[model samples]
Target chain A: PQNNKSVHCHHPCKNIHVFQKVAGIVIGKSDVKSFPDRKNIGVDRFTFSFTVKDSPDFFINVTAWGNDGYINLLSGSFSVGDCVVIENPLVATKDPEKGERFCPTTPSHYRLLVTEAHSQVYLCADIDTMDRLLPLIHLPVKDSRDFYSLGDIVANGQKLDGTVINVLAAVKSIGEPKQFTTSDRRKGQRLEVKLFDDSVSSLPLVCWDREAIQLVQTLIPKETVLFIADVKISFDSFRNSMAATVNSKTIITVNPDTREASLLFSYAKEASESGALDQDEKPEDAKTIINIVMFLDSITDVYTVTQLKEKAQENPEAFFGITYSFISKLDLDSSVSKVIRTRCTRCKLQVMEETQSCPNQLCPGRDQAFSASTGFDLLVDFTDHTGTVHGCALRSPMAEQALGCTTNEFTMLTDDQRTAMKWKFLLERCKIYVKILPSTKMRTGIRGVILACTRADPGEVKQHMSALLQRL
Target chain B: RQTQETLTKKPAVENSLRILTAVIDGMRHWSQFKDKVPYLFEIFATLDSAVTVGRHGAKNFLMRDGKEVVQCVFYENEQELPRLIRGQVHRCVGNYDRSTDVLVCVSVRPGLPSELRNAQEAVKACDAEMRVLVKSISEV
Candidate 1:
């Protein structure tokens, strides 16, 4: 207990007068941010960060600042993946409000500030030390197996929204890097890559870091399996879905020696061999989207339940087909939690928690008054006498329109009224337009996104069935 | 309901009960088999609003479309079932008591609702399915 005094401060934060040395490999380095002094008339201050990992479990961010000459010389002297040693760096508590978002997350509560004329950073000259440090680069910050599959992320919905998580998937496609200027006039670039596994068909992973984007550019899609650790998963309100982002804390391990990665590697190899990888790359022409609305009259390609099952096995990027379904009962008696999905208006990227503070670091309303949006986000399985298709994402505003009640209005119904209200449509012969994607064979299931669900006139169902039966 | 789970696993126990599809038109014909075997049946019908709750946890129900009607009684002592709304079609699976001609219920699943005029159309399909299912049970 007597030696525990420096536990909170470590060696760095307790006293600035003491001399200390830290050695590690430079795992990540950032570009410089040069800005004029707000109070001073002419002088400019330059700053940047380079993260160094000394041990397999420990890493710290070293933020440096000086005039343009000192900053450039220091940043240009070494590159990412280089081994470095710092002597007499000042350790201080991280800025509580901005630190978590601004810098990479570290186990320690403090970060080292490299000041001019006092601290020094030089490449580690010892071969023995460098040998031990460089191999740590292959290690992930989190366990490789501790990752969420693409389907698991979507299934969790907004509960996992704005939370950091590890992911295991193969790269489906990588988009060309696009350059832009931030509103603050700083230059920025983003490269988006689509990832997929057996469970989910497609998901987007966005990289804003120059280092990360560069590493991604060299990779071949479908041939590569990535075990991305500490990646931030967020609800993209823009797309009304979930997406992953590579951040400072994220460390991507490319095709590591792990059972999960090798299995995914094999899946990537098989999916590519069939040439099913690029099926989703080209967006179907505008006419296809419009057909979702004009489905009844315009679209004529109808599939039976068995036909839908066979098409999923073909592994298309996504296939659109019309099916006449009982869409009935929805196996109601589904627990209330699955029946109604509540999202924080402040978190999704939606609402906050019981406390005043929103847990989502990326939330726009993080510091504001808490508010929420609750709606029917159901996974209505479509079934007939033949087979069943599970978990078609039926979310609002489509859910509200199909249920014929506003989310707010639905909140007022009693348990009996809710059951009766739901029974109104669940017990109806329906015309359903769905977009299907193949799922992991682990669960012999397919994921369907219902584009439109309409209570079909029973006569229309009979007519369609008769037509389908004739073709069969 | 827990006591009847044997029907799900035992193949011989399953062979004796045919899940005959029924419509209101001629489901009365199924009563004749009630004295022969404790067979299962699935009937597509709608409930009348007038429900009578009896002592000993018994509840009485009517499944009818105008003149076509059948009586159903649910006797799950403690468990309360999901209340199905009136005029909505449901598939009720149960056994018929030979003495009373009452459908003693096990489970009810909400089904696709159609007009009473469509009831004849439903009967035509069910009659064909019933023949095939009944033939399978008799052969076994």
Candidate 2:
């Protein structure tokens, strides 16, 4: 029998094997975590985990265990997104309580364990020769001390809309990075870090570059002060405010050894101690808040449609949230045109003029006969006390659930029957889960899809409102 | 024996339309009967379906399962057509053309193969509705 391991692992769980060497790009690295050893009482044990992926679909969690100094040294040697090679590691089955509690959920059934005596980690030395490999961020533009206060940027928001400037501020909070695929199937990631200074309470600084997101991922919220040099300033007309973008010309210095940065850092620590900073919005606080509410499993960060609009404008990253609103407009009673569309089974594109091939020029099955299925494509309006959102997409299978019928059944209903069905949801309050996307081309300034739509339970609504009030 | 009756009536195309609905809508797959209805059918095992609109605006498609392949034809009732999901078993209900073995659809929708045994009423209702549509098309 051949003993060679295949690139596609059949099932890593079946056998425990020692990997001589494995190389992958580090996607995430966590801070060094320590716990008091239960068996040793007086002694402490330290461990840190990082995730590496050789391909887009597969990534494995690797943890190193050693004394405080050794674990710190190993973790600090490589930043996220670096191509790193692990030598002589044991592949062990994962413990759900220990592994998944802190680390990301992975498809691999087993994780790599790195120990002090048996394993070593190295940054791939061959990376430079492979120039096509992801590029390292340029070193923070060699110590330019000049910077702008958050207050200054806001005061001159219009004038600095298109200019480059340095900003010095303490991290108020950092949001989880949002990963999305563009229409062309290209992957993109965005992270938003909220910054605050003595002059300004809060300003969103966005990180769109991959390396930039990884760098900001390591910063401790409210403890680290950033000196961002040559960052682009853009005036957001949607929010009627200003925001900064980190780009190629920008270099971020974490905890810069400067008098101003040090001063802001101390101020941040003081503000956090005094309870002046609102910590409720942070994901870390969600666990305790969840325990108190007890019914928060289905709900996440609830917002009124008006607040929802502001939230989308505040950060470029996409987010999911629930809103209580009325179905102000549902076009079921109108002409039954375009409500049901035939999509080419091969490419899933709309077939316009009844061709026998996919409309997509590059579709794999373009030369084959075109097969299509019809489904509901609906546009609806959601209104709350704050405001109304126009043209929110309510598409199939969710649309089928809300209307209580299949596409075949819907087409059979007369206009009067459709109108009667529409009236049932038209003015009634509904609890709608929506995925909001900041859209520039839309007249409403924001676009969204209704993930779920159903009638709101009055008692549940009251209870949810009280929870929000208690938090406030 | 049943295919012979269908062949004889194939020449009276206008009569089939005038009597539709009942004549075509009530028509079942030949495999389903020992007696002849107004039409014939060819059932396929694998699903290879396509819907195309011709120059005069008639929409048609082919249904092919590996065991056999059959054609279905229609016109203007695009809204009435069920969205055929790929990879699911589907059937076309139309009078069979013995010469071409085409299922000129009368638009009857059968419940999926799994549900067909229990969905006789739903199928009956569907056949009635499509019969009206075919009758109107013939008048046009």
Candidate 3:
């Protein structure tokens, strides 16, 4: 008592001894209460409570406030279970009974400077920030809000939604024709596929189209990026987990959206890891895209030189050369020409002539589009047993070679390899179809030509065209 | 630039921690530890409003600078304690009735040591109840 001296300063606790700092060990802490109050000095006090293990049977009262001018500096993101260390504690007290003498308690008069703030403290409230808050490990949102109704749970049907999420797996079976069953109980074609990821290697993907199914026969799991958007998930008969059911409505293919593109890029990287890449240095279906090319055949009609010219009216570069010459010979009405267009996949420049460079130097995707002098006069659309159609054009020597071919030869697509060749040579508009092609040499020695004007499916067109294709 | 901005800002919990720690450390009469201070106590109490206990009660808490805290009630009991005092700070000095037993504690936080409040609550519970009067040392 003799050594006690009254001192005045900005804070009450600043004059206290060093040994009096800090109470219990930094152990488990919890929130008991938090509220707002105003001090007699016209300052606001936002009170908070914390429970500690070692010291103090009574709860610690902490007022969360600063001077009036600095109130805006506080963060609103604080939450429960956040472990915080306080520096420079202060305290104050008051009379418990109305008529009782006014008394002060040492513990109540304190100010603590908060040191470290962790975002994990608010993890429960902000599910969206998990990636930014959590470090190192990759965590996918398993709260069912992000899932696209497609695919199944990797683990057996455990808790449908929980924090302990580990694997996000989807069905990857190549559909087998034997498994194809329509809602009417009619059997169609199916392709079986296996699910795969770089994390776990590979699985199966089931494609229902005959050409796609046939192509899947030779496809390695590593070389495909399946974007099953509206795939509805159903409980298996065993009720072990939810699985994907592909009907005619299932769009089990890659799309151009960022999410789907990212999936494919990763898938391609995974395929490359498994030696799925060919000598040609082409990216395995699942590889990241270094570049992209976008061309429109027709919004309403199958793409043709006339449609391309109309679409390409903005730039002569995409239309003038081979596609233009072909359009000039055809007795196409101007209305048809306006329906389709071709432009640089990179710069969207309308290509005009067969040249190595575009008129706009910055325009990429610039290359000799087919050839200028040599133009294809014949257009053939081929449809397979599965109802998917693909179209191709033949000109000069190739058309002459096919002029005398029989219908059987012209429409022959006996295997998946042939389907892939037609797709590789004639079907550049579709990336997903190219990714599903079978990996075999059967298509290396094939060609087809048709004299009759019959429309066919794009998927079948890929199968019928057997020509040892010029480089695409 | 961000670091500079952060360094200039004052902390949020400076007031409560300062008041709590100062009284706990100043108290010297407890049989459990050396001197009158036998044991150490740290209590965490949260009232709905900072003024839930009123200006007199807050000032009284500040007056006990170094004494063992007995019980701390954070929740309100309107039926138990009626006619609570209105908590006010930074008003004109002449308006306050300092001559009487009731005096509003308007002192700013004295900036005390932090660890004093860190004293265990269990230690404070073990102490004898000593009534420490709350009185204004200065007009401000």
Candidate number of the best DockQ: 1
Inter-residue clash pairs, candidate 2? B40-B96, B45-B65, B46-B65, B46-B66
lDDT of model 3 at position B66: 25
Native contacts conserved, per model? 0.02, 0.00, 0.00
Query: How large is the i-RMS for each model, in angstroms?
Result: 6.5, 22.8, 40.9
Candidate 1 shows a clash count of 9
**Model 1 spans > 4 angstroms off:** A1-19, A35-42, A182-185, A237-241, A273-453, A456-472, B1-140
Q: Which of 2 and 3 is the better model by DockQ?
A: 2
- Highest TM-score against the true fold, candidate: 1
lDDT of 2 by residue, A282-397 (tens): 54223222221222233366776667888887887656678866676788877665677667764567776466666687554444456676667788887653357789877665
**Native-to-model Cα distance after best TM-score fit, residue A298 in candidate 2, in Å:** 4.3
- Which of the predicted structures, 2 or 3, would earn the higher TM-score when compared with the native? 2
lDDT of 2 by residue, B25-64 (tens): 2333322321222223213223466667776666677665
Candidate 2: deviation at residue A282, Å?
A: 41
Candidate 1 vs candidate 2: the TM-score winner is 1
Docking class of 2: incorrect
Once fitted onto the true fold, the runs of candidate 2 whose alpha carbons sit more than 4 angstroms away are A1-298, A344-349, A352-355, A360-372, A464-472, B1-140
DockQ of 2: 0.01
Per-residue error for A240 in candidate 3, Å, reads 37
